[model samples]
Target chain A: MSTLSLTTSIVDATGRMLAKYTPREKINWGRLGVISVPSVWLFVFFFVPFLVVFKISFAESEIAIPPYSDLMNWDAEDTFLSIKLSLANYIFLFEDALYLDAYWSSVKIAGVATIITLIVAFPMAYLIARSEPNKRNLLLMLVVVPFWTSFLLRIYAWMGFLNKNGLINQGLMAIGIIDEPLIMMQTDFAVYIGIVYAYLPLMILPLYTALEKMDMTLIEAASDLGATPTQSFIKITLPLAVPGIIAGCMLVFIPAVGEFVIPSLLGGSDTLMIGRVLWDEFFQNRDWPMAAAVATVMLVMLLLPIMLVSDGQDKKEEA
Target chain B: MKKTSKFLTSSSILGFLFLYAPIVSLIVYSFNSSKLVTIWGGWSIKWYGKLFENEQIIEAAMLSFKIAFITSCLAVILGTMAGFVLARMGRFKGKMILSGWISAPLVMPEVITGLSLLLLFVALENTFGWPAGRGTNTIIIAHTTFCLAYVAVIVQSRLSMLDETLEEAAMDLGAKPSSLFFLVTMPLIAPALVSGWLLSFTLSLDDLVIASFVSGPGSSTLPMVIYSKVRMGVTPEINALATLMILIVALGVVAAMVIMKRQHRLNKELKE
Candidate 1:
């Protein structure tokens, strides 16, 4: 039968492919197979999606099912392929003050939050790293334990603490500190608190790693030379920990710029963040192309910091 | 030095208090008898009971767990293979591209990732008529895509730090390549694998934004449900649920620390 002949040919092809490699070389093929699994998976799901976003960003918005017009269409009557593309979305993003303000505020807020987190986390990391060797791991574990809990719940907890009748207000009143509750919830202050609280662990770990690995002998030598402790810290410790500082800052800043949940939950309606803008454009207005444009721009903005962090990591690995 | 030590100790205490205060308050309010989360009434277990009775929340939690479990398992397998390849295979073609592909998702924002993946699913559905519609399957794929990056990084670092001579010695003893891997490399990397799995599981379970994009009508995860509710305002039931989550996570962390400490002591004793 024809089916039998086809099956034989299929088997013949595979046998020929296998025969191309010697027994020892076949292991190399297996290695290829192993490496190919994740590479192919990432290519299909991660890389390809980004390409899809790029493609869709050039298309026009439509009321159709997918909510975006196809870039290429087949004309049935004329029997010809037609391509349609527009730069209006990108132009609109540039022209609109709302989008501009969102980007500006996102960077400003994330930057401030990152700086505050570093100021708080630096001393904490130094203390942990400088602790007795036997006790250091316990301190490190305490820092990491908070990170294991739910992020959303942590933010929600902040909401409770910041609300009008919340604990912070009640505590202040009970202690006769203030007669009125400070306007904290649904404000920019709350967003900063949520971000700083959530990202503190991230900022601490790298700093701890850097500080722990520092040479105590250098500090001791500096002190022996009659340099003050503060002077030695500034002269030696600060310079050595720059890599960690940069790494922690980028780790906090990059994601914080594109953050949605914190701003949405904790920020006031007047708060303008690009992540919220993109969400609204896509989900509310059903403007896929415009949303894609926003995201693409956001990615471009974040690209430099991301590369800096990754490059720093590579250097650290090399060292 | 004494003055500096005092400063360090006090600062460390304040830092920890800052970190834990909100969580402690959240837990305390979960026991409040009143529906309002801020107003303190007499203590009661009513919210815990109410949380159990809510069928929607129960269903959502189960779905989130199911997705996380499946995502972590797949991520571990794929990630381990990728990690092994990166650690062992040196100076290969496209190495830079491969490494870049592995690390890119780590820094990519969740919103952009979600948007792009959503578009991919839609386009694929339209073209191939497969994956039919977005739901749990789509969410799993999206989650695994990101989670695998974390697992790969962890496993890769662990593998690089390991001594490769053990594998070579195994081979010299006439062990086959596959067996050498299973009996030697796997056992050595078992700790890394466990940690990687736990990290992936937590990341998938904690996700809200990416899940929101890829999930469909009937497949809402627990975070999605909680997010919708939290948007309106906090409720006693949510506080109760959060407390339970915190307790479970705290227990897991404590157990892990205890085990790690025991292992450390055992290693020291063996060396001595």
Candidate 2:
């Protein structure tokens, strides 16, 4: 019968495989192989580098090949331990107004940019979400396709638009609105424009996802009870979209805080973002320990937002 | 109600215009004959010729493409494995730590990630004498590390949505674990894998900050080259390059959308 033939084939397969390992051993090995590759990779590349930054932050700067003193050294007679670990770099960060000012400005700029992006993106997301179902995909694609182009190029485009002889200025001049071209390039205004433009897509996608999934009955119910459209939006829709807002704001804020290219290319000497500071310390000043300290401080500052995002993900999964 | 709807439609149109105007201008200026990007002269394609003639740009672009291709492949393999374990593997020791490691890159600031990886490369070179120097290899590794997180998220979501009954039935029919995976699970997750690959590819290609940190002399990626040139000022040649990039990306996106729509229609018809 078929059963007998199947049993015979199973036994033959087991007879050939059981010589090397059991089924349980095979599964365990497979599982280990699956997990170890990424685990080892993350530990070596991601986690260990963080520890290195921490380690380097404590060492003294030196005009040497590695550019930092060893954390520990031995005396010539080998009788004493010479520890070179110092808080000079961190102390320098605290003592310097440049570093403090950079941090403050970075927070202010990124904060304002996040608000602007959210305000601009919210209406678009709501409109797209409320559109006819068949048209929603096409609208969403329009928002996202621009994101596929090079970010650097898009930021570069803003440079052309915001320059003194740029499009905005030229248009204003042609319309006789101004006698002189506006000094928009290399100003804080330019920085804000660049950040908001670059990060708008990131803001829109999350908002759209949340809004599109929202039940329409909530809004309908509110309207049925005589709440005006604006009142319903402020009271019902905005409150319900809190999760998306938080996600979108975090996405915009965190990266914007450490945004180097925008501030470097678009911002003038007045805009001293922490990322630009870190870059100058590392590349221009050749101060590795100082740069490491800056990076470490930034990581600490960002830990809260990162935790909130991950925690948000966990809550969603649980729900 | 009618007023609100009209307002919403106008706002949406304006929002999209804000998004597209700069790009449209960049493309338009690429055709301008003037050396200055803002000024309008006669139309010309001379910049496109210059863009192609630049050996440095060509080399950097080729390198970027090669790195992106390899990074996406590696990221997919490693990410699929990590995602599979997260979705299918029941609770095990250190699950929290594993998941944390997998997701950390998603929210970590690029500056920090770049600095840490650069430091790691320096340390590795000092200790092992391998990697020899920081360049394409380091950039690819850094890209894979982050892109892996994205791929894992996509694949994990896809896996969670898949029905388990098919795999169970396959096992009940005497399929080994490996055979069950290939015959049942892999085919089901093919779409996720494809999308994951594309996402990773684009991310690797678009990276600038991290590549700036990790790339060495003569190994500058396209973004690095473009950033350097763009910092000086917007030149017509750069505009030409940007125009070409936009055209390619636009074409790719359109092609993908069309294919996805066709596939959706096919599925609906089959169901009917």
Candidate 3:
């Protein structure tokens, strides 16, 4: 590799001698060679898997013995071509109201939860960010510490808190806040609570970064200009923090859209989300092709937020 | 006159209460001695004791730790390398595609990722007679795939922020590229590596949807076990386990904060 690159560079310099283009010796081809190994590793292990998923989504589902089919059978031409690739799965997706309903419900739930999460997390993250420098780290740690535990465990903890005769209801009834239990568990409300609760940190972290990096002098200058606190916040603070806010929203909104565990654990039977539907199709219903179609749709829906966040982060980092 | 302070105090307090109350109640009730999960007949460590005695839960916890440790290590190694390349290498053919692929898993829902991976594994097994079975190995592979993306993003960002002078200086001093990396670049990015490893470890341990989809019948992680137990019936033992996890996590966070603080102080002193 080195010899080839060296010869190429030597030739390039000579080749470009009369071409008026400058020659560069340090091509960093060696670094690329080293980098290529892991790049290929990710491509094979991560990228190819998704490609296979895309391929399978266009194929007809076939039943076989438990687990999967025999390995050697794929080598044969007849068996290979017999797999029958087509768009039947995509057509099936359009025909299924359940799949579409689940997708809509996922959007609604995630949308509401994201709004509520921003409302709940913004003030706290703001206060923490604006706090004294010595205490700032401690406060940030406190916010993130909850996330260090199992995300699923946090959702499960809500089970005890939301169960009928659970602490929240029992306390409410004892205090005469309500005449009856709120029926908090196994409801859409419960699913919303779980999602917001689990993803709150994700929102806060980016918001905190944005807020903490803002110049306090700007707010002070606005105050000096006789602007009210709320005015200063809306004009100076919020606008400056828009990138962070966008980043945070993108982070929370994308994953929450396809969130399954929270809804499955906390949602009632009436609750419908695409993730749950996808899980049912693949695992319970044993409809691999249809499930793949659902996943493909999710992949498309998820692309927007993913692009938004990645671009937002890149801009923030560059700035 | 003092309305804003009062409102701020009240609202902040309310927010804290809302966030911490459910978790506190869950922790407190784990000590309840009664069979009824909701009722607080008395405080005792009986649930914790029972949790220890449950062989299945214990095995699951051990299995979870094993998987988390292995997968996190694998993710850090693969991800750090990928990160280094993306951070250091200038634009090349397929660079955009490579970067997009790295970000895909981070945004993809766990269920979709799980299903897709399962399909991939089945396809490979059918094609090449390799990875003949699905179980622990498959679970590890699936987790490493997703977790590697996260680690790569973190480490890549850190690497991008790094001063390029050190590596250049090392290279000019007659050090080989490989030696320059091990001596200077690695040390400079060590914090990001540690952060990546911890993040991956936490993710692997926290995962349930992907693990459930990919894990074979006999190889259940702690979260999987807890999920099944919760589905079967609410158990105080789960609360006990959760509370213990909280304690461990809290300690880890506090330690991390202290280390970061010390490092910051050292950097300041060096500058002075």
Top TM-score prediction, candidate number? 1
By lDDT: ranked, best first: 1, 2, 3
Cα lDDT tens digits, model 1, B126-222, are 9999689999999999999999988888888888887689898998999987898899999878878887888889889989999999998899999
lDDT of 2 by residue, A13-67 (tens): 4665565456555446877787788888878888899999999999877899778
Q: Can you tell me which runs of candidate 1 are displaced by over 4 Å?
A: A1-27, A76-79, B1-4, B267-272
Off by over 4 Å in 2: A1-27, A75-81, B1-4, B267-272
**For residues B71-188, what per-residue lDDT tens digits would candidate 2 score against the true structure?**
9999999898888877887545454556767767876878889988998898888889867898989999999999998898888888887768888999999998889888899887
**Chain A only: TM-score per candidate:** 0.90, 0.89, 0.85
| Model 2 vs truth, CA RMSD | 7.7
What's the residue-level lDDT of A297 in candidate 2?
A: 95
Between prediction 1 and prediction 2, the one with superior lDDT is: 1
lDDT of 3 by residue, B44-111 (tens): 99989999999999999888889889999999988888787778865445555566668767767888
Most accurate candidate by lDDT: 1
Q: CA lDDT, every prediction?
A: 0.88, 0.86, 0.80
Clash tally, candidates in order: 0, 0, 0
Indicate the worst ten consecutive residues by lDDT in candidate 2 chain A. A1-10
